[model samples]
Target: IIGCSIAFNLAKLGAKNVVLLEKEKMTGMGSTAKCSGGIRQQFISPANILLSIESIKIFKNWQDEFPYPVQYALDFRQAGYLFLLHSKSQIENFQKQMALQKKLGVVTVGFVNTHEISTALPYLNISGIVAGVFCASDGVADPASCCAEYEKQAKMMGVQFLTDVKVSDIGANGTTRRKIEVVFTNKGSMLTPCVINAAGPHAAQIGKMLNIEIPIICHRHQTIATPPIKWMKKNDPFVIDYDDYAGQEFYFRPEAGNENTGYQLLLGGHEDGKIQIADPDKYKEKIDQDFILYLADRAMNRFKEGENIQILTKSGIAGLYESTPDALPILGKTEEVEGFILANGFSGHGFMHSPIIGKIIAEIALSGRSSFDITGLGLDNFKTNTRPPAEKAIV
Candidate 1:
C-alpha cells in the first residue's frame, strides 16, 4: 500500500516515468494482505498523530480527495476506538496524550469513565477497567480494497508496475560518492536515479544490498476472525484492553457481515513481553493453537457473549511487522546514500499511514524535503543514538 501510494502521489505531483517493481505476482501479497486494518490517531508521538490525521482525512473523503474517476469502496467505518484503561498512571498518560491530540485538531477524542464504557457496550465485562479514552473518528477499513484503489489510481496516472520482478542489487557510481545508478532485478537491470525503499517487512534486506544497515527487524503477529453471531453488534467500536493484565492484551472490532452471517468480529492481541522476531519469508503463516485457545479464554473472561463465539480457524493469519526501536517509521533521506530515500519501518502502522507517507515521500523525491516536518523521523536519530520519545500506542 505504501509503495502504491508513493507511486500515485508521485504521479499526482507531475513526476513522470515512475515505475513500481513487485517481487510477488501481485502487489499487497505480503504483510498488507494479513493486516488487521485498524486505523486510529491515538498516539503519544506527535509525528504519528499528524500522519494518522492526514491519512484519515483521505480515508474519510477519498471520493472527493482522490482524482480517480472510479473510486473503489474502502469499507471504512467510523465506529470509534476505545482504549480500556486500568491504572491511574495509564489514565494520566492518556489525559496528556488526549490533550495533545485535541491541540492537534483531533476533536473527536475524549475521556470516558468506566460506567460510560459499560453503558455503551453492555456485553463487555468491565470488571477491572477504571477509565477509557475514545476517539470517534478512529475506525477500521479494508486493506485489500485500499491497496487495489491505490494501485489502480497510480496506474491510471501513468505509473508503470512490474510484477514478479525481484530486485537483486543496487549499483552506485563510485566508492567515493554514494549515488544510485541502476537497479539489478531478476528480470533485467533498470537505470534509475532515485529509489524508494518501501519493501515492507523485507526492507532490511533491500538496504543490505546497498550496504546500508537499516535499523529494522521483523516481528510475527497473528489475528483471527470469528464466525458471525446473531447477538453481534454491527456498529460496535474497536475495543482494546490497553492494560496488560495477566500478561494478556487483547483487541477486537466488528467485521462486516452478510445476510447469511449476521455479524462477526476480528480479534487478536499480543502477550506482554512476547517478542517473536521472525524472518519475513520463513515465519509461520498460520496462528498457533495455544494462542487461539488463549484468545477464546480471554474473550470469555472479558465479554458476556464470548462463550458462544466460535473461531474460524481457516480465517486465522499471521504477518510480519517491520519494526523500529522507537515504534515509529524511518522516513526521509539517509545520509549514507544519495538518490536513495527511506520509507520503511512503520512498525505495523504502514497501512494507516500510507496515504500521507506516500505524499511526503513524493515531496522528498521531487523536491528536497517534505511539506510536513519529518526531522523527528530521520535515519540520523538511530545513527547518533539520540531518538525522540517512543510512540506508546502499538497493538
Candidate 2:
C-alpha cells in the first residue's frame, strides 16, 4: 500500500521512471489484504496520531484526488471506534490522552460516557464498561479496494509494477558512497539512484541485501469471522474490549459488507505471549485449535449470546505484523546507508500510516527532508544501546 502511494507521489513530483517490485503475484494481496481494515486516528502516541491525522485528510478526499476507471470507493465509514473503559484509572487515562490527541489536531477523539455508549450500541452489555473513548473519524474501511485504487492511479501515472519479483542484492558504486547504484533481483538487475524499503513482512531480508540489520520480526496475528448476524448494527463503531486492550481480548468490527462475506462480525485476539516467527513464509495461516476454542467461547460471552449463536472459528485467517522493538515505525534515512531510505517496520499500523509515509518519502526523495518532523521515528533510536521506552497502547 505504501509502495504504490510512494510511486504516485513520486510521479506527481515529476520523477521519471518510478517502479514497484512485489514478491507476491498481486499488490496488497499479502499482509495488507488481511489488515484489520481500519483507518483510525485514536491513538496515545504523538507519532501515530500525526500520521493518521494527515492520512485521514487524503482518505477523506480520495475520490477527487485519485480518480480511477473502476467505480470503487475507499468505503471510509466514519462510524467511530469505541474503546470500552473498565476502570476509573482507564477513564482518567483517556481523559488525559484525548486532550493530547486533540492538541495534536485530532478533534474527533474524545471520551463518550457510558450512557452515550449505551445509546449508540444498545445491544452491548455495558455493565463492565464504565466509560468509553470514541472517535467518529476513526472507523473501518475497505483496505483491499483502497490498495487496488492506489496501484491503479500509480500505473496511470507511468509507474511500472513488477510482481513476483524478489530482491537479491543491493550496492553502491561511488567511492564517496553518494547513492544507490544498482539493485539485483532474481529476474534481472535495475540500476537506480535511490531505493525505498517497503518490503512489508520481508523487509528485514531486503535490508540484509545492503548489510543493514533492521530490527523487525514477523508475528502471526489471528482473526476469526462469524456468519451473518443481524445483532450487530452496520453503523456501530469498531469495539475494543477494555480488558483485551492491554491483554488477550477481542478487538472487532462489522465485517465489510461484500459478496464473499455476509452480515458477519470479524474479530482478533491480542496475544502478548505470542511467539514471533522467524519468517512469514513459514508461519501457519490457520488459527490454532486451542486458540480457536478460546476465541469461540470468548465470542459468545463477549456479546452475551447463547451457544446456539454458532460464531465459529472454523475458517479463521491469519496475518503477520512487521513488529519492531518499541512497536513504533522506523520511517527515515539511516546514518549508515545513504540512498536506501527506510519506510518499513510499521508494526501493525502499516495501512493507517501509509498515506503520510508515502508523502514524506516522496519529499525526501525529491528534496532532502520532509515537512513533518520524523527524527524520533528514524533509525537512530535502534542504534547501539539506545532503546527507548516501549509504547503499549495496542490491541
Candidate 3:
C-alpha cells in the first residue's frame, strides 16, 4: 500500500517519471492482503498515535477523495479495544501509557478496572483480569480492499506498474559521490535515479543488492475464521487480553460482508522468533497447528464466543514484520546510501499506518523531509542503542 500510494502521491505532486515494480503477478499479493487490518490511535508513542489519528480521517473520508469505491467502510465500531491486565505493574504501565496517549490528543484510551471490564464485556471471565485499557477509537478494516484501492488510484494517476518482475540488483554510479543508475530485473533493467525499498518482507534482500544491510526478518503469523455464530452477531467489540499468563492476544471485527455470518480471528505466537530466509524467492506458506491452539486457548478464556467457535478456514502466509533491535520499525534514510530511501520495518503495524507512511514517504522523496517530524525513526537510532521500545499494547 505504501509503495503504490507513494507512487500515486508522487505523480500528484507533479513527478512525471514514477514507476512501481511488484515481484508478484499482482500488487498487494504479499503481506498487505494478509494483514489483520486493525486501525488504532492508542499507541505508546506520540508519533504512531498522531499518524494513526490522521490516517483515520483519510479512511473515514476516502469516498469523497477517491473516484473509485475505496470501499471506505471502516465498520469502525467505537466499541473500544479492551486490554486485560493481570499484574499491578502492568496496570501501572498501562496507566502511564494512557496518560501519554491523552497528552498527545488521543483521548479515547483509558484504564478500566476488572469490574468495568466485566461490565463492558459481560461474557469475559475476569478471574485473573485486574485492569484493562479501553480505546474506543481503535477499530478494524479490510486490508485487501484498501490495498486494491491504492493500486487503482495509482494506476489512474499514470504510475506505471510492472508486475511479475523481480528486481535482481540495483546498480550505483558516481566517482566520489553515489547515484542509483539502473535497476536490474528479471525482465530487463530500468534506469532510475531513485528507488524505495518498500519490498515488504524482501526489504533486506533489496537493501543487500545495494550493499546495505537492513535489519528485517520474515515471520509467520496465522489467523483463522470461524463459522457464523448467533451470539457474535450482537456486535462484539474487538477484544484483546493481556493477562500475565495470557500474554498478548487480539480478535477483531469480521470481514466487511461476512461480519454477521462469520468473523476473522488472528493469533500471533511465532515461538521460533522469526525465520530468516536468505533468499526472498524461496518463501513458504504453512500454518502451525500448535500456535493456533495456543492462541485459541487464550481467546476462549476471555471471550465466550471463542469457546464454541468452529474453525471455518486455516491458512498462513509469510509476511515481513521488520524487527529493530528493540522491535520498533527502522524508518528514514541510512548513512551508507543516498537516493535510496528506506520504509521497510513496520513490525506488524504497517497496514494500519499505511496512509501516513505513504504520505510521509512521498514527502521525503519529493521534499527531502516529511511535514511530520520523523527524527525519532532514523536508522541511526538503532545503531546508537536508542531504539524506541516496542508498544506493549500491540498484539
Candidate 4:
C-alpha cells in the first residue's frame, strides 16, 4: 500500500515518471495484506493523532473520491474502538491522552464509566474494566482492497509496477551526489532521481544497501479468526484490553463473511516480550498455539459469548511489523542519503496512516517539503537525541 499510494499520489500530482517495484508476486503481499485493518484517531502523541485524523478523513470519502463502483468499493465500518480500561491508573492515563486529543481537535473521544459500558454493551463482562474510552469515528476497513485500488489508479496514470523484482542496490552518481541516479534490480537497472523505501519489514535491508541505517526490525504479530456467532450487539466496537496477564493485549473486531457464516470476529494481540526477527521473508507464518490459547482465554473471561468462540479455521496469519524504537514511523529524507526518502518504520500503524503519508511523501518527492509539518517526527529528531514521547497505544 505504501509503495502504491506513494506512486499513485506522485503520478496524480504530475510527476514526470513513476515506478513501483515489489519483491512479492502481488501488491500488498507483505505486512499490508496481513494487517487487521483497524483505523483510529485516539492516539496519544501529536504526530500520530494529526496524521490519523487526516487519514481517516480520506478513508471517509475514499469511495466517492475514486468512484470506481466495481473495482474501488471500500468495505469500511464506523463501529469505533472501545478501549477497556482496567484500573484507576489506566483511566487516569486515558484522561490525560483524551485531554491531549481534545486539544488537538479530536472531540469525538470521550470517557464512559464501567457501569455505563454494561448499558452500551450488555454482552461484555465488565467486572475487570473500571472505565472505557470510545471514539465513534475510529473504525476498520479492508486494507488489501484499498491497496489494489491505489495500484489500479497509479497504473492508469502511467505508473509502472514491476512485480517479482528485487532491489539489489541503490546508489547516486558520484558526480552529483544529490540524487539517486539509478536503482539496480534483479531484472535490470532503472534510472530515477527519487526512490522510496517502503519495503515494510524488509525496509532495514533496503537501508543497508544504501549505507543508511533505518532503525527498523521485523517482529511477528499473529492473528486468529473465530467461528460465526448467532447473537451480536448492534454497532459493536472493536474492543481492546491492555491490562491482561503479561501486559497481554486482546483486541477483536466484527468480521462477517457469507450469509451462512452469520457473524464472526477477527482477533489478535501482542504477546509480552516479543523477539525481533532478522528476516521478514523467512520468519514463521503460522500462528502459535500458546498465543492462541492466551487470546481465547482472555476473550472468554471478558465476554459471556466469548466462551463459544471456536476456531473458525485452522489457518491464521502472522504478519511481520517493521518496528522502531519509539513505535513511531520514520519519514522524510535523511542526512545520510539525498533523494532517498525513508517511508518505512511505521511499527504497526502503517495502514491507518497510509493516506496522509502518501500525500506527505508526494509533496516531499516533488518539492522537498511535506504538506503537513512533520519535522519533529522525522529521522532528524532522532539524530539530535531528542526524547520524544512514547506512543503507548499499539494494540
**Model 1, which residues run further than 4 Å from truth?**
245-247, 259-261
Which 10-residue window in model 2 sums to the lowest lDDT?
A: 255-264
**TM-score, predicted candidate 1 vs. hidden true structure:** 0.97
What RMSD does each model have against the real structure?
Answer: 1.5, 2.5, 2.9, 2.0
lDDT by residue (1-395, candidate 4, tens digit) is: 89888988898789967889998788999999789888888888888899889998889888554524438556778889999887888888889999999999888899888777888878788877778999988898889888998899888888899999999998775544556788998999988877888898988888888777888878888888876765553247888877744566888877766555556778888777654464776887888787777778877987787777787547577888888888888888877667899898888899999988888999998999987987666776787877368787777
Cα displacement (angstroms), candidate 4, residue 120, comes to: 2.5
lDDT leaderboard ranking: 1, 4, 2, 3
Candidate that scores best on lDDT: 1
Give lDDT tens digits, candidate 2, residues 1-395.
87887888787778888889987789997789778877777777788888888888877877766646645567887888888888888888788878988999888887888888878776666777788888888877787887887788888888899999877888775556556889888899998888998888888888888778988899888888777766776777888886743556667788745544435788777564664474777878887776777677666666755364565567587789898888888887877678888888888888988877888998988897999788678776776555445655666
Which predicted model would earn the best TM-score?
1
302-367: candidate 3 lDDT, tens digit per residue: 566656765554544445455554445667666766788888777678887887788888888888
Clashes of 3: 0
User: Between prediction 1 and prediction 2, which has the larger lDDT?
Assistant: 1
Off by over 4 Å in 3: 64-78, 244-253, 256-283, 305-307, 313-318, 384-392
Cα RMSD (Å) between model 2 and the true structure? 2.5
Ranking by TM-score: 1, 4, 2, 3
TM-score of 2: 0.93
- Indicate the worst ten consecutive residues by lDDT in candidate 3: 269-278
